[model samples]
Target: MATSVGDTLEDDVVAIPWTSFCDKAFNCLVKHKHDAAGSSLRIYASDFIRVYEEILDQDLLLERCKELNPDLEVTAAYLSEHLSQGITKALKQTCTAATQEACMKIVTCNAGLLVMQLHTMISGVPFLWEFRMPAQTASDAFYRHVTLPMIVMIVGLQKQQEDLFALLNDKDSEISDYKRSGQHLSRKHLETKVFDAGRFRRETLTPKHLKDCLSNVHLNPFGSEAGLMYRKMMEAYKDITTSAREPETRSPKNHSSSNIPVEVVKETRETTTAMDVTRLEEEPKPHKVKKAKKRMRL
Candidate 1:
């Protein structure tokens, strides 16, 4: 069994043993049926790897890691080396694809749980689920790898179509502080910086800067296209916020509003009036005695 440097072996380690623990855990999941085809250890490994990869690909894992160690430089290289290595090792041991997939899921879940447990132990914070990297580094990574180049390409295309729109819009300017030198800056570079700075500001500083950067009204064709994308992104953010704030249970008044209460009230009143008229008709009416008097006179 591979062990880390700081970890001390407990007495249980010697007596109960890792092998026994694994066997028990595996058996607990899949009853101790000895058939190799039915329940293999590799299944767990594969499941664990799949989950681990998914988490790694998402921003949540890096965010969680940052929460744990704020100063740690969590580069893509570091992730591939340390975390991915552990996952690969676990996966490689599995003999079958099905077994491997199962194990990957288990390992990923276990890893996340372990991180949470570790954070709790270290910081006494129960909900430290995501890790965050340094603001500047994270911004750089996001722009360089994801949004930066795209924005740069957009700006470049816009510049070719319209000269007036060449200037960085209000939204871009607010997110980024310009370092003016004698040399002119390229459209691509400016756009890249804008996107990166915007993301950085969102994560670390206030998002108010984003409004300023986006406020420039001069629309090139490319700018208009980008604006639509930006709006969609904002909508998604709004939806997330709305979902979080939405009440779990609605009020009785709200529930009743779905039915046509005004119509119901009108129907009720009409029914009452009709019943009253029917009751009046059912009552005996007084008969005139004129006909009997006339007969007596004749």
Candidate 2:
């Protein structure tokens, strides 16, 4: 950990704890959340480097480079291969050696940075690289890293919502056309209610609802069914993006009429017709009581 004092000098910097930094960032966000017309906060790339070096004290290995140039470049293939191998090795060692408490301490104290534990392989040779990260960030770092990205993400999601709403309306129009042409749906359960975006925003998009969901973060975000669901969603997204495309034609077995028994088909037809008739007959009819005739026993 690094410590610094506030002064109006060239090398003056104040390093706060990671927890305190986060708290201060959160309070700032909450204070300015409703300031919609206010100008957005300005951030620079140097802010990231400054916090990492002056606050976290992690070496980024820039000093080791010739002339301390930050614009050093490498081939993408080389970079990816070395990064993957290094991460695999690091994860194996960490999981095998580190305890749960030790892991938590690393996150809290060191700001989740693995100091000087990475190695890069080049031409069948390995070399140590001290690619460090900031343990303690600046007060506005959260806005740059988290809040700005979230605002952009919300804008994207709102666009997606509008697109979906338009699609639903088009679908409803097609369904209405079918109905106007005297075409009926085979099943009542297939009919969907009209989408109400206003209702959804009122009921689900409330600040209280969001606050309640965020309040449960302390109870282990990845140690519940929600974590499993998140993994499943990621798997689905991966499959859709990377898997091979499906065939255009349907399989013959799916539409084969020979698979159905005659008795079952007749029963289904009769049941559907009976249901339709009952549904059409909305008027209630009076029921007459039948008089019981006295039985003469022989």
Candidate 3:
């Protein structure tokens, strides 16, 4: 519901509808999908927030999922949780934890489907069939807010991260940007925006509007660790771009580069952590905080 001109979406931000997202996902998985006797979509999705808070078995998931919609076919079952908020899709029902390696495969193989899913989460009105995301904590909200835009900015060909948010995500930030003359954008001010955390499908945020909300990579966000997460994504892309352009160079090639396809290098949102960030030592301290706050954001 952001009405201010600053909140308007940039021309580069792509619009995605929920139905289009799911249909594309279904088409991509049609090869692997089959009708299961008792399979359901509602079980695991009954309430994502609660399910994520606890460990669950496949049978219980089937009962709940099937009860919600029997005909709904899942190419891959979301068998396990990744991090606190990451629920992964897989083919098996053994409740195996989705490995980062597998996520890496999805990134390489079905990036379009992945980006579509992100689009659904970012803008589609909160609906049931899509993964029912629950906002429970600052970290959850923070990841939701940043992850959507981050994907479009980096993985997308058409969409780019808005200038406003990009300024905050800049790997190199200066002290004077946050303050000019005697003005200071206080920690409280940053937290308000971080907590405002726009993850809902209907709400939109623009960079010009975010200038009042965002700060350089100096002062830490008080609530969510989105600041830390962005830096890691930027850093990881070095290897991602290198691998995409020439996967063979990074590892032994089973096929020629021409035969192998390059896909979006979007890292699994669940797999990214603060530990993955290696630039903390190089970043100059924010004058506002004696020491930088470092916590897992994604």
For residues 210-292, what per-residue lDDT tens digits would candidate 2 score against the true structure? Answer: 89767744333323343334333323322322221235354655434222233322222111000000011222221232222
Clashes per candidate, residues 3 or more apart or on different chains = 40, 0, 7
Residue 179 CA error for candidate 2 (Å)?
1.2
lDDT of 1 by residue, 1-298 (tens): 3221112111111111011012213311100101112211111111111211122343544564566545443343333233322333332334234342112222213423211111111111121222111122221222222232234344444444344333445556644444343344566454454434355436644557555655632212223355345333323322322333356565666544222223222222111000000000121222222233222110
Instruction: Give the whole-model CA lDDT for all candidates, comma-separated.
Output: 0.27, 0.32, 0.27
Deviation from native of the Cα of residue 13 in model 1, angstroms: 34
Give a tens-digit lDDT track for model 3, residues 53-85.
112235654453355435332222332122111
Evaluate model 1: give its TM-score.
Answer: 0.18
Best by TM-score: 2
Backbone clash pairs for candidate 2 read none
What TM-score should be assigned to candidate 3?
A: 0.19
TM-score per prediction, in order, is 0.18, 0.36, 0.19
Candidate 3's C-alpha lDDT?
0.27
The parts of candidate 3 lying over 4 Å away from their true place are 1-57, 65-133, 138-141, 144-298
